[model samples]
Target: MSENLKKDYQLCEEIGRGKFGTVFRCFSLVSGDDFACKSIDKRLLTDSLDRECLEKEAKIMQLVTGNPNIVQIFDVYEDDSYLHLVIELCNSSDLFDRISKRTFSESEATAVMLPLMEAIAHCHILGVAHRDIKPDNVLFNEWNLLKLADFGSADWFLGGKSMSGIFGTPYYVAPEVISGRDYNEKVDVWSSGVILYMMLAGIPPFYGESAGEIFEAVIRGNLRFPTRIFDSVSPAAKDLLRKMLCKDVSKRFSAEQVLSMSNSCLILIVLFKVEN
Candidate 1:
């Protein structure tokens, strides 16, 4: 006997907080399931716009439900003055934590990226954009798979039109976004490049003292990879980075093109070549 929604789900502990929400690890009283509840205050949103963001989060999550790389948003319920997102509790810490410890092995990167690329590529096919694609937004350990979480900043690329109101984290944003130009799927590619760079080198290519500086660096293509830092990786890895970090939206790689090479059936192919 599981109560759907009313009081608390499982009562684990407060995990983290962002500008707009708090994350909790809770176990379901019903069916004994575990879940993560992100309780976001409607008032905390940057604009009075979160009503739409919350609704969009719920709706987009429903579309993203069955994805192996997406956190399953179970329900969005509101009582007197609260909005709760009941999501499948993705157990592992974020990819950022992993990088903080050690660089990902080639196979490890492949395992992580494969399903994630599938999910994002599918999302694009479905006409959605996961505007935020930072390592902090990735969760693993639920069946040892990378589950893309936090669609709070998502935007639907609806009806073949470009929508405005800037979205995405600063470092992961595409150059076009930084320049305030009309952009699309290429934004996702840029973020994916940053993610892959982090995976291989244990940090994002763009570094800066301030947010604005980071935006400038990304837009100016001011990132440089030390041959020493990338010593173990391959030239193809650099090629991938070049394609993803292009300043021109028209010059960036598409997810389809990125996924097709596999270079050895594993796209992004990692920095190391482990035999044939």
Candidate 2:
């Protein structure tokens, strides 16, 4: 821990852990406010590329803090051994945990997705791409509002400059990423599609016994809406998925376009049900 961190805050408890670091619940001494502190060890970031990504993640978080749906970073503390990030504390469970607890109707999913897409669009508009957009990275605030978290995979993407690395959770990764082709922010849209599919169907769009099998399925780019799971889902919802999960990156809908259509889609679904 940094001397500054020791002076300013008191560590409470370990809240979460991921491949990159451990997150702790902390209380600010001066403000009496609570925060999430991500402690990343310097030794684990020995690779130059990893270190660069770490720095960029912090910069991206700093750039996009004020957005209502994205997690906010308050302060940063560094020491010889670790880098600590003091961010908005979200005590509620992540979307994945919530989903595992129960199923979500299309309407409920839309309610969750609209703000998500808006936040994503906000990030893209600001030139940031959240390479990881899975449910585990989506947290709920005390108000029960969804907040996008974990910018460890986030970076700024300038127009006409595409990224080539394949970085994302397996089930939600875009096909182009699996193919090792250059991709852009649309990759996030594809991940959103996977999330949508999972939300409505209670399982990922692609699944297999092994990671290799899952990657093969993803690369194949076949979307399955099994009658048992999706027969009750709205056509408009399915249409949006088709557009979002398109194998051809050029055919994929942007976040702005999706947001424009999502409201109308939900409204139509509601009307159709009422009429029936």
Candidate 3:
């Protein structure tokens, strides 16, 4: 977000808050659009590295603003207490919120994925990887496009920290991330794989009694597609899921490859895998 980009919105009620700052609803005077303003406190961000990571996210948002699939960062500003971020206000909540209510069909999966893939595709081309990509981080706009948000953990290949922790949601953790291996863009593929698996299966690929058990299973690369759950799913959809969740990053499907599977690819990515 560019400070030079003028801030023309008046802040409304708070919508979200995190470690760094709070998010509020606002109305944009220039575009006449509703937007969310994220206010980050520079004082709370003590670590220089972490602060730089936030800065990098803002910078990337500048490039991805025009992308249809991405959450648009309308403007950025700083005052005495905090840095204000005016981003596109997604009317709908996150995928997790939806999962808590109704069941979804395969066609619905395609609708959600179209924009998700487009935004992610943009990030990959720019060499930026969203380290955290679970259901909660994925928001929905009025059109039901999955607006990828919460870029707090997002980092580029050349900068940011040595990402070695168990970063993402336990259910979505990729093998490489669990192993503490120096990973790359492929980590996003692994997360998307988990999302796709849940979308089609109504549950994650692996299950355990505890977080330790889940991490152990992930670290071991244990994967199983039960015929009982997937009995109704198409072969092409299953094939696409297999490609996204492939343990080896070298062979996993790219966002483009997964999107190509489209109508047939629709059923397997999100409707079944997520558990509220």
Give the candidate number with the greatest TM-score. Answer: 2
The positional error of residue 77 in candidate 1, measured at the CA in angstroms, is 0.8
List, residue by residue over 1-276, the lDDT tens digit for candidate 3.
324334577678899988888998988767677889888888888887778777877887886568777788867787666778789888787887775565456666557666677777788777777878887878878877668887777777655334554567787878888887877776777787777677766787877889889888777776776888877666656677678788887798787776677655554445554521
lDDT of 3: 0.74
Candidate 3: which stretches are off by over 4 Å? 1-7, 29-32, 158-166, 263-276
Model 1 stretches astray by more than 4 angstroms: 1-4, 7-10, 263-276
Candidate 1, residues 165-258, lDDT tens digits: the string is: 6778887888777777777866887898888888888877887889999888888887678888887676666777788777777777777766
| RMSD (Å) of each candidate, 1 decimal | 3.1, 1.0, 4.9
Task: Assess every candidate by TM-score.
Answer: 0.89, 0.97, 0.84
Which digits, one per residue and each the tens of the lDDT, describe model 2 over residues 11-80?
A: 8899998777899999999989999999998788877878988888788999999999999999988888
Better of 1 and 3 by TM-score: 1
Rank ordering of all candidates by TM-score, starting from the highest: 2, 1, 3
Write down the RMSD of candidate 3 (Cα, Å): 4.9
After superposing candidate 2, which stretches have Cα over 4 Å from the reference? none
Task: Please report, in order, the local distance difference test score of every candidate based on alpha carbons.
Answer: 0.76, 0.89, 0.74
